[model samples]
Target: MAGSAARELSFLTISFDERLVEVGSNKCRDAFRELFDHFAPRLKSFYLKGGSEEAAAEELVQETFVLIWRKAALYDPQKAAASTWIYTIARNLRIDRLRKEKAMIYKEEEFFATKLTTHETQTDVTYQNQMNTQLAQAIAKLPAPQAQVITLAFFEEATHSDIAKRLALPLGTVKSRLRLAFTRLAEMLEGSKQ
Candidate 1:
């Protein structure tokens, strides 16, 4: 409606950066509409100059406005002028769309790729999950001292020396427990396989 358009212009009374901050803090639809009014045409022209179809340019403008709304809080006036920052966002989004289209083209070319490969990948994932479950069960079966050492070494990704420091144990003691734990796990897994 003409009333909506007039309201959009009313927002021009404030600076663009202040409007963006208002979008950030208040999520005001009128402020957003104002921003859309100001930027959408300029963005469309920029896109058209770079060879986008009219519909695609319009879509990009809509998407850019959406980003402005959602990511308003991330805007910092100290970094760059509002126009420069907004232009950068639109440019990045366009590049991303082009890259995604290229990637999808490659994906489409792989449509004839074998179901056998997909099945094998699924089977490999299943096997890995089962092995992880069995290994966790085996670790659980271990005595507390051995389990503690194994957990610190593998689960927590602590080096043996780090484990020694964390647990206030001697390095030799930590190494011995780890050796015993590994031997027990090998035996347990072998029994489960049989």
Candidate 2:
């Protein structure tokens, strides 16, 4: 009985090893399917035992199989059994996933560490409010034609050609109006600062 069990074990190992070699040489889907069917469940169990969540374990299994398919040509029976090589791939993939997760967490912690505080947010809002008020007063003092072009170009984000088409003016007339509007607004805002 002991002799028969040893023979069976040896046969199974050789069979899988041969199948893996066939996959490398021939790109045989049938052999790959058999390997996947045999190892996927066991690999999942291994990952679960290693504290991976169900989803993460499933991902690791998928990544391992993909690598197996891609790197089958690199396998050497003299270096390791097929099972040992496959499990090593899974282990390395798990380590990579953990490193990426750790990096994302570190980035989040760094962003929070340097984030603007409530006081800074309030001061920014106050400064923005003052600028808006001053800009509104300056715009209100602009002549109607210049104000119209400024409103269309800056507020409505219209192109100069579009503003000329809308206002039934020449393109050069539209450009001059925008330039004059900017100059007047700058002078008004500069005087307000004093």
Candidate 3:
């Protein structure tokens, strides 16, 4: 009887282990949803304290979920809770957005400085005008979508994801457009150099 009891306990333990594995597989959505429902408000509070408006905070929350969905396969249950993983995604995305915004501001400043220097030189107005005309002609030759992508990426210093969101495009489409645009621009610039 004692031997049978031991055998029954071992079988029960094995069954529980299988059940745990099934639960692990099935629990991703539930885990993510619970994590989102719980931590979204906390994330909003964090963003608000960091000076984001309510709308921006909400947008960040949505972006965080999107990232979490994309990266859910990377989550390791042994390493962190779902909440920790989600918060880390949120924090990292916020940092990336802030850095991009700062870079955009810096680029604007540099462009302004370059314009000032160009104006002050005034020594080759005709040559500069010719170069400008060439550049305009090259840009005009690009397809409309390519032109638009280049404008947003270079002139506006928009990130690929930002441009994708702004243009209501997929991130893959944005990346492809930008790649094709750069290839075309490089070919044009290289031809002009010859």
**Model 3: per-residue lDDT, tens digit, 104-175?**
454334235445644343443233223334455667778999899887765454688988998999999989
On residues 35-139, what C-alpha lDDT tens digit does candidate 2 reach at each position? Answer: 999999988877776668899889888988998898888765544457656755775666566687744554333234335332332323223234334566667
Screening candidate 3 with a backbone cut-off below 3 angstroms (N, C-alpha, C), the clashing residue pairs are none
Best by lDDT: 2
- Quote each prediction's TM-score: 0.44, 0.49, 0.37
Models ranked on TM-score:
2, 1, 3
lDDT of each model, Cα atoms only?
0.68, 0.70, 0.59
Q: Which structure is stronger by lDDT: 2 or 3? A: 2
Query: Number of clashing pairs, model 3?
Result: 0
Candidate 1, residues 1-194, lDDT tens digits: the string is 85564445333423566677778889988878877888889888877755588999899888989888887877654333456457667766666676876544444222333332353323222233234345556777799999999867643546899889989999999999999999999886556433
Which segments of candidate 3 are over 4 A away from where they belong?
A: 1-28, 101-194
Comparing 1 and 2 by TM-score, which wins? 2
**Model 1 CA deviation exceeding 4 Å by range:** 1-14, 100-194
What is the lDDT for 129 in model 2? 30
Better of 1 and 3 by TM-score: 1
